[model samples]
Structure formats: C-alpha cells, structure tokens
Target: MKCRDGQMIPKEQRCDGIVNCADGFDETVAACAELRCQSEQFQCEYGGCVDGQAQCNGTIECIDGSDEKVELCGRRILVRPTTEPPTTAVPRCELPKQPLNGSYSVVSETNTTQTDYVLSYTCDPGFKLVGHSTVLCIEGTWPDKMPRCVQTCQLMKHPSIVYECTEEETEKPRQCNVEEIDGTIVKTSCRKPNYYSPVELPYMHCQQGMWSSGPVCTAECGTLPPESTPLVLRGSTAKFGEVPWHVGIYLKNPKSKKHMQICGGSLISNTIVLSAAHCFWNENTQRLEDVTNYAVAVGKLYRKWYHPDDEPFAQKSDISEIVVPKLYRGVELYYKNDIAIVIASRPFEYKLYVVPVCLDFNEEFSNIQLHNGNRGKAAGFGLTTGMRGSESPVLRVINLPYENYESCLNLTSPALSRYITYDDKICAGSLDGEALCRGDSGGGLAFPSSISGQRRFYLRGIASTSPPTNDQTVCNTHALTSFTSVIKFEKFIKAYWYP
Candidate 1:
C-alpha cells in the first residue's frame, strides 16, 4: 500500500529484489518486464532484474515503462546520493616543570612523541645556585625539576691585628676558609701547608702586627716527634740521672820502666770506640792494638780508685784500625779535627748492664752548648781522686760543663791552641782545675732525646784530652778534659762505618 506521501513501503514477502510497492505486484510485473538493474541493487527474483539471462517472463514490460502504459504500474525512481565530511583527531601537549631549590635547570617532554628538553638554572642578584645545575626530561616528565637558586653564605671573619692585612684570594675545593694570626702582618703565599695543588685567590691577611719567622716553618710532612735516643745497653739497671765521666788507661814503656801519657777511650758502637786523634797522632809507641789495656765501667756515681765492681762495667776489645784525618797535624791537639775512630776487632755484645747511645747529626750544636751542655752524663773507670791512683771498682760518673773552645785551648800548649776549632771540637771543665781527667780520653759523650715513645740518648762528642797544663800544676789540680764534636764528624763516621 502507498503511504500518504505516495511513497510505497513494500510488504514483508520473499521477493528476489527490492520492490517499489507494498504488495508483491511490483515484483511480479518487474520480473516479466525483463529489465536489468545496476551494480548498486541486491540481486533477487521477480525484481525486473533480468541478470545475465536478459529473458522476460510472460508479462508486459512494466520496468521498461511498457508496464506503466500497458499494466498501469507506477514508474521506477532513482535514489539520491548524500554528501558529508570526515572528522579530525585532537592535538595535545604535556606541562613543563620547575627544579628544586638551589637548582639551576629543569626539563620537560611532549606526551605524543615523548621528546625531552633540558634547561639551566640561574639565581638572582646576591644569590647563588648550590645544587645540581641541570636535569633531563624522561618518560614525558623532567627529573630533578623545580630547582631554586639561593643566596651565598657570608665569609668568615679575619683575625684582628694592626699590621697590614692581606686578602684571601683563593678557596679550597672542599673547604671555604683561610688562616689568620694576630701580630705583625706575615705575607704568606697562597700555598696551603698540607694540600697539594691547592687553589688560591691571591693574598691572605695576618691578624697580628708582626710577621712569623725562624726555623718555625714546618716541613711538608708535618710536625715530627723528637729524634731517636741513643740506646744504652745497661740503661735499665742504672738509675736515671746524669753522670759526666770518661774512661782512660796508663801507657808504659815495654822495655823501659818509663811511663808516657795518652788519652783514654769509650765504647759507643758494636765495634766502634771514640777517642782523640792527638793521643795517637804522633805517639810512635801507641797503636790501635793497644785497646786491650783499657775498659769501661758504669754505675759508680763518684770517682773511686780500685773499686772491686769496676770489672762488671768493663768490656775490653782489640782496636782494629785508627782513622784520623790526613790533614791532622800531630803536634797540636787539632781541636776542630781532634776526633779519631777506633775500629774494634770484635763487636761488643750488649748485656742487660750496658747500652749504646744514638748519635744526633741534625741537632742544634748551640743548644747543646747552652743549658743542656753541663746537663750530660759520663761513664768510665777513671781515677776517682789523686794522680797515680788505682782504677775505681764502680764506673765513675761526673757532671761536667760543655765549655767554650776558646777557654779550653788556653789550658793546653800554646801550639795546640790554634788546632782546636768549634766546628770539630767542644770544650768542657776548668782549665786550671779538675775536669775530664787523665783516664777519660777517647770516651763517648752522649745526649739523650725522647723519640719513638722511648727514653734514648745520642752520642754527641768524644773525649779527646786533658787540657795541656804544667806537669806540676796538672798534678796539683784536677785535669780538665776536651772532646771532639760528633756533629762535625757525622760525615766521617758514616763513611767508614762499614769498612
């Protein structure tokens, strides 16, 4: 049936093709008309769709318009084509972020492509950026973003002083301060004491009015403890105190009963003993082998002749060689080069009662001459009292002054005066009275220092001689002694140490 608009809605029937009217009448006549439809239509029977056969059933040609005139069916109409446009996708972007405080840079990314961006950080005037200055964008987001630059810290105050003040120019990589002292202005280089390749600005201020000076400058290695002390073999048993004495022996003619005098000696090494060169320099009768006649004793606080205990401190060894400088003039006790070396035939094995002292080479000689000079200890079995006295049983310990060389030379022969020089020799005791006496020649003088956390002593000088005095006066007064300075002979000792 046709609607009020005259548009026919086809009836729900099994038709081979689309029909123009509701009844199957449009399809039956269209099949008989034998008209072919286009590719747009659905193929069906009884729809004027002749298809490939192009044969009409036994009916009038209504689809060909022949049915419109003959069968009186409505004419076929064409459907119109509608026109509309395609839709487009929307565009989007991710938000950018800021770095944290003290930060200089931040990063951002686009969501669609995930592209990264990095930015640098900057601070305002009077402020500083102290943290990481840059960051990278990752996963559509920036890591370490929103950085804030902060203010710089105030510089540390300089020490107060009236002297010209220097400015600190450079700062350490990890540190931010400079050193200042009050006093006179001391101009110091930018070099840091303990750091290598230290950075600098230019100048630093000394707070005080005066500049610092002297040997006070420290080494690059920093402050070190005191020098090693000379080791004493029997140091443990002996009471701790000062003993300034020396050992000596008598020289007698083997053929004639006549007696001659020479300086005695002391042991300071395993195979070395110290003495004066003048004692053996020109003396034709004396030989290095004569060392067997001498001995060393410790423990006796005072001089005593013929003490029974002297043997305990006494150790005797043969002298292998006598080393004296070739320039040495035998006539005078060459005060400066007055020292000699005695090589023992065998090394002295230390026992609990005997010890050796360390020698100080770099020590200050002037210091040893001042307050600490008379403050030394001496050990030997020299005569306790009187000429021609017997040996003491206990080691004779005495306290002696380290005297000036000028005064010591006055006591000796006039010819010997010029031989003594401060560089090689040191003087001790009274020229006209008792001093390092007759039997104390060739002994070691020691100075001690606390080094390596232990009590130690250093062999400082060697006993050389009894200052030359009139034979009658020498007997009337106690003998004054002199020694060769070990500090001066440091090179000489180390040279022949092995040989």
Candidate 2:
C-alpha cells in the first residue's frame, strides 16, 4: 500500500492499530472503514478487526468499546428474570475540586450510555493560573490535573535602583522574585550612595500580587549655594564650597616625602576626576608618569597642604589609575585630545564642599552661542599674577568670555594656530592678563546650565595649554588659553566613568 506522501508500506500494515504514515493517512477513519475482516475475526464498527473469540468476553477489544456492548454480549449471558423493571446502565465521572481563589465550569458534556465532561478553570483578578485550564473526565476519573491560582508581584526594572529581598524567616538574600507572592516586602536603594531618590522610604510592598512603585535614583550633581553670586588668579578668592567640584592634583616629592599641588581637575563623579592628559605624562621620559606618585584633594581651600583652614573639609584619595586617549601624543600633536580620567583608590565622601559637577552628556553646552559673548568660569590655584609670580595658596576663579573657533584662531599665535581644531578644543579666557596661567592645567571650564529648574555648572572643557610669553615667562597670561572640549570626548569619558 502507498501512504498519502507516496511512502510504500505492507498491505496488511494499513489499519493494523498503528500509524504507517507521518500524517496518519494510513490509519484515518475513512481509510480504515474500507478494510475487510477475515472470516474468523469480528469487525469493529469504527473499523479494524479482532479474533472472533475475543469479542463479547467481558473486556473491550474495539477502539470504540463496541465489542463489549450489552447488545452484542447479551446472548452470552444467562438471564434471570427477577427484576421488577429493566434499567439502562450509565457511567459517571467524579467532579474535580475547585482551586483556591479560582473556579471551574463544565464547558461540555456528552452521554451515550455513559457521560463524558470537559472542565475549564479560571482565576480571579490579580491572580494567575499555574497549569492547563481544561481537563477531561473519563469513567469516574479526571485525566488531566487541576490548575492553581496564585497571586504575585513582578520584579521592578530600573537602571539606578537595586532591589534586595528575603523571605520572612530567612537571613539569606534571595534573588528578587519575578512574581513575588502577596505580602512580600522588598527593600530598594540607589546603586551609589552619592545618588538620591525622591521617595522618602526605600521599601516597596506587594499587595494582591501587584507591587507598589519603586524609587528612582538620581545623581545630586551641580548643587550650588543659593545666596552665592556668579563670580575669579588676577581673579578674586573663592569662598568655601564656591566651587565644590574643583579638585587639586598633587604629586609627592620622592625626596622630601611632601605633597605639592601640581595641576587642577574637576570632580565628575565620586571616584572619577576629569583632567588634562598632559598632567600625567612625563615629557622627558616620553611615557605616562607613575600612578603611585599622584593624589587628589577635594574640598580644598588652600594650596598649602598644611594650611589650617583646609583640613576641616578637605578629602584626599590616592590615584589608583590614569586613563588617556590612545591618540593623545604628549605635546607633539599640540595637545590634541588632551583629556584624562583620574580614578581614585577610594570614593570621596560627598559633602557640601565635595559635590560633583555635571558633564555635558547631551551636548547642551556645545550648542550655546559662544560668539554672543557668553562666558564660562575657570578656577585653579595657578599663578595669581604674571608668569614670574608665586602660585596662589588660595583657590580663585576668573570669568572668561568664550570665543568661537574663527576668532580664537585669529588671536592664537601663528606657530600654534594650526593645532587649534574646533572639534577637540574650545577657546576661552581673555588677553587682558586674566587668562589661565601656569599650574592651571587640567582645571575645568564650567558653563552655567539650567537643569531640573535649577542653575547648575556643567563642565565644558579642560585647560590644556596657553602660548608662552615672548619673554622668558613660561606662561603668557594675556593669551586666549586652549581647553580640551569635554563634549568632544563624551564617549571616552563615559566608558571608564560608568563602567
């Protein structure tokens, strides 16, 4: 015989109580009904055949159980006429028990001297089913298991918050439940201690299988004093907490075992400082300086390490690592891509004087009209006067007008103008002896930006280099200083800072 798919099989294999074709075409009802039974066998009503002696023997041999019907087997039994009336036998199935918080209904029923039923189950609101919804009943028994209804809460998904949970009696922390049961409580907190949430409490509750809202962690960056006015070496001295994000980069003298302020940086995160790559490069060695030789001081008011006024709020951390772009080539390329990230050995404790400044992640600061005389603030403990003057012991800030690339190029020295590209550098400061001088390298150029209905300082650039004076002075205070633009290296900064 040939199957529907053209596969060959033995003639007797068709309708032999087995499937010979992948689609079951050989055993289908229409095909099986055309089969003939041997003289010594009894044919079933639905098709197929059995031994003659196997029929009407008190057991079913046919697929439909027609071989054991009373109509066909009655002749084989001896009848005793003692009953007052003849009654037809009927088969019944036990009803399944109802699940808690759920119900079941008879979706269908059929009778042919016996009853068969189909049951469907459903859960109440805020509840979920755990198993198959329908079950079949056959001969006083259920063939399928009953389903269960359970109430639970889904796990919260947030970038800044983390959730921890434990069962009522367990001390071990468990994986947050995807479907936390009713009455479960979860504790939430920001991923970093320096971050905050609008929610007063750090707990969430699961009720009726649904979870309450969770807290969202937000970085408390760029906070400033309410009464302080926007105001700086030739610049005015800064008050305490005036520039909270500014940090002093120091190097320990190997011989004296004393730390000395070298460059300046800005705190972009609790453990990360943004600065100029040149600060960490050794020009003579033609390689990066030792990380162990560096340290960062936050909340610093005085350049002198022993200043009594600086100790109370000052926080210090050893440098664990220094990161600079691979394209940065000491001073050969004219300090192109001169950005660096300083990672602290330990996170600085955030305080009123140790907060962080915001980074222009959205390029909002870059789009501003710099040609309209918009100015930015630059702060450092750099030289207070001319190149020959002593470094300022106290921090000071100077407001410098931002200049467009074209104007900056015109003012730049002819020897250095070729290296001042618009994408990698920003031009700021004034030519009236108010520019960033020696020791101001790596300090931030901050521009005021409105964020969340508050005026906050966003770091726009890092002080890189200024043209040298025509005389013997190392720094020309009258030149427009070039700063490495923060917006240009946004991708590089985030890779290390966020990771």
Candidate 3:
C-alpha cells in the first residue's frame, strides 16, 4: 500500500485500524474496505470498514476513533457469547455450550441449501427459551451464541409461588435446573378483601428467579362513577328512585345519637355523598364536627318515612368519613367551595328512591344556556310555605329561573360579591317569589341534560345559601337565590373526594 505522503507498506496494514502514513491515507476507508460491508462487518468513518463484532467492543478497530465512541457505545453492554466460560461463581455468568441432542433441529434462515446462513432455533412444546433465538454463521463458523431450551418447573403441587431456592418443595420441579432463573407466572387470586396483582390484573409473577412482592388490595373509602341517568322526579312529588341520587344528611341529635337532624347530599357514586361542608361545621364550637357521628338516608323523601311506599323507601348508611377541602378559610356566611364528600360505611342499595346522579362536568350542557333566563328545577324536602329553614316531610320540586348577573353582583355585602365567581356561583330567580329555603343547602339544582336522547337530570349546582330573608309571611318572590355551580369545581371535588 502507498501512503498519501509517498510511503509504501504491505497490503495487510490497510484495514488494521492503524495510521501508517503522515496524512493517514494508508488507513483511509476507501483503501481499507475490502468490499461492500456485510452483516458481520461494520462501516467506519470516511468509508472505512472492519469486523462489526470489533465495533464498540472496547478495542478501537476503526482508524477514525469511531469504534468505541460514546455516541455509538450507549451503556456499553458487552454481551459476551453465552457459550463463554463463567469468569466468576455468580450463577448468571455464562459457560460454553455442550454437545446438542441430535433430535433438536435447526434450519438456514436465508435459504434451505445455503450452509453459510443464519441458524434459527426452537424447543419442544414445554421448554423455556434462553439466549437469542438466532445465531450467525461467519467464515464457516458460528460466532454468535446458540440458543437453548431449558426445562421449566412442572410443580403439580406447589404454593401460590416458588423460587429457585425452594424448587425442591415443588412436587414436580424442573430437571437439571440452572441455579437461579426467573420462573413462569402462576395464576391465582388473594381471597376476600385481600388481592394479588402485578399490573392491576391479578397474576403472581415469579420474577428474577423468585416470586416478587406485588400490589395488595387495601380498604379505601370511595370510588367515582360513570355516565348514566337516575330517575327524575315528577312535577313536585318524588317517587321511588325518582331523583335517586338525592340523599338526606342527618346528624345524631347532640342530646341523643339515635335521633337525626336533617341536611342534604347528592350521590355521585356507589358509596359517596356530595354535600355542603357546612353540614359538618359546628357553629356553636366554630369548628368542624366529628365525622363518625352522622348518617345518610337515601331513597326517601320524608326524613322519617315509616309507611310503605310503592318505591324503595330508605336505605341508611353510617357516615364513615368526611372530607372538606381547605380552600375555604372556614365555614363562612358566604358558602364558597362549601363542598364536601361524605363517605358511607356501606354502599346505599340502589332502589326506587336511591340512585346516582351525574355531575355537570365540563358544563357539557352549556349550550342549553341555563344562565340565560333558563329555569332550573330543584327537588328538595322544604319550602311550600316559603319558610327559612323549616322543611315539609314530603319532597317538593320547584322551578327557579336564572337571575340577572347584576343581582349577585349587587349584593349588599362586598364579601359576597367578591367571593361569588361567575362559574362558582349561580343566581337563580324566584321572580314571582319561589326561592329555596335554608333546609335546602346541599340539595342539587338539576336541569334536563338533553345531550344523549335520555332525559337525564344533570346537577348544575348545589344549594349553598338562599339569603334566608324569606320566611312564611315575609316571602320575597322576586329574590335571587345564590348557589355554587357544580361545573366550576367538579375537578376539585373528584380529586379530594374520590378514593
């Protein structure tokens, strides 16, 4: 070979990854490359080519420093041939292969008649695969490692899992087993409330030569729900399941835990009650009340309904937990987020009077223009005579129109107007004087959700504060009642409420 500087050398030095000339022309790719690079050979910088196996294998086989450059090396996994003898006593260290059984078969991957083609491998019906499935043929010799089919554990009698160390405990263990190889997955489930799972789905995985710790099912308070329509109440009277998502909150009378004081809640899911945060606030103490001292009644219109009705009457669930968001400074005269989740110890049985109601998430029915003079309906246990907090035992439905925005904006209290947000507070009109009463707090303001053909009543807002000025004789029909719109804080409700 002749160098660019007019020096000459033997032809063998051309592709040897060495600089033999002043200008390094003797090791140039064009002069070094014997022919078009093959699968077993690697193309280097400046058109140079060398044995691909030598590329990034610690030794620089390319004259241009391209062999082991960091860009091409990645994590530098030096996958030595599985057939190499182990360098240590560590079980995973590899060793050369022994003579294979003649019965095992292999075929040329490229052509049936070609002896220099790749070898493909597979095992019989019941065998574990190890190493690459294909090995390459180079210069009449296989340079890559050959794959093997090892026997798996055939544990007819075993526990929920087995590891390499306890393989002997299995009734039908693997034969000639390697020291510590990951085992196959075992199928089973943990009984009762306890659950076994790896990826949500239950499956005992024997990973890294042994059974790994998997996810366990623990008791949680709530789970959210999906799309559906519960029964809607008729003009005024609530039938069984009609307005099923509606719930009546009752605190154990301070004097007696057996007696209950009525409040209101909306059932968003199986075991969750969406209610007003003020329901748990003890005004006397100026603090939140203990959660364990409350109960929720579903599927009933009358707080103390005793007679049989055509629909499912009442299913009472003990309040196990209550979560009120921290956004509100405390229970204020103006109900802000005033929202809370009441977790029931037992799921309310879905019946005529008990069902779930879909929240006005995303304001999906915004096109309905509920705020633009649209009249919304509310089915609550109060206000036939327009009393402040007094509620009749029977549920009553009343249509309240959308009030002028200027009304909530013109409230005498600056704090009320300042805290009343466009999305959060909705001013419903009682132009002829049919506004909500104090007992209606937490009751839902539902409008017809005509999105899908179904007549689903989607809760738009929760009865927060109706300005308590209306009592029997002083009923102001033209007053606008303020409510916390459900669409505004549905996300915050879901995040803090749902388990």
List the RMSD of every prediction in angstroms: 30.7, 18.6, 24.0
Q: Mind giving the per-residue lDDT tens digits that candidate 2 earns over 320-426?
A: 99999998887787789899999999988777677788876675446773443678778898886655567998998888788888889988888888668777998
RMSD (Cα, Å) of candidate 3?
24.0
Candidate 2: where is the Cα deviation over 4 Å?
Answer: 1-202, 206-216, 232-234, 369-371
Q: Once superposed on the true structure, which residue ranges of model 3 sit more than 4 Å away at CA?
A: 1-235, 254-258, 305-311, 330-333, 367-369, 388-390, 410-419, 470-478, 496-499
Q: Assess the local accuracy of residue 438 in candidate 2 as a C-alpha lDDT between 0 and 100.
A: 78
The C-alpha lDDT values of all candidates are: 0.44, 0.77, 0.57
User: Which regions of candidate 1 fall more than 4 Å away from where they truly are?
Assistant: 1-263, 282-314, 332-336, 365-374, 383-386, 390-394, 405-419, 430-434, 468-471, 475-480
Candidate 1 residue-wise lDDT, 58-82, digit = tens: 3322232222232332443332212
Better of 1 and 3 by lDDT: 3
* TM-score top scorer: 2
User: Any idea what lDDT model 2 has?
Assistant: 0.77
Model 2 pairs in collision: 232-235, 232-397
TM-score of 1: 0.41
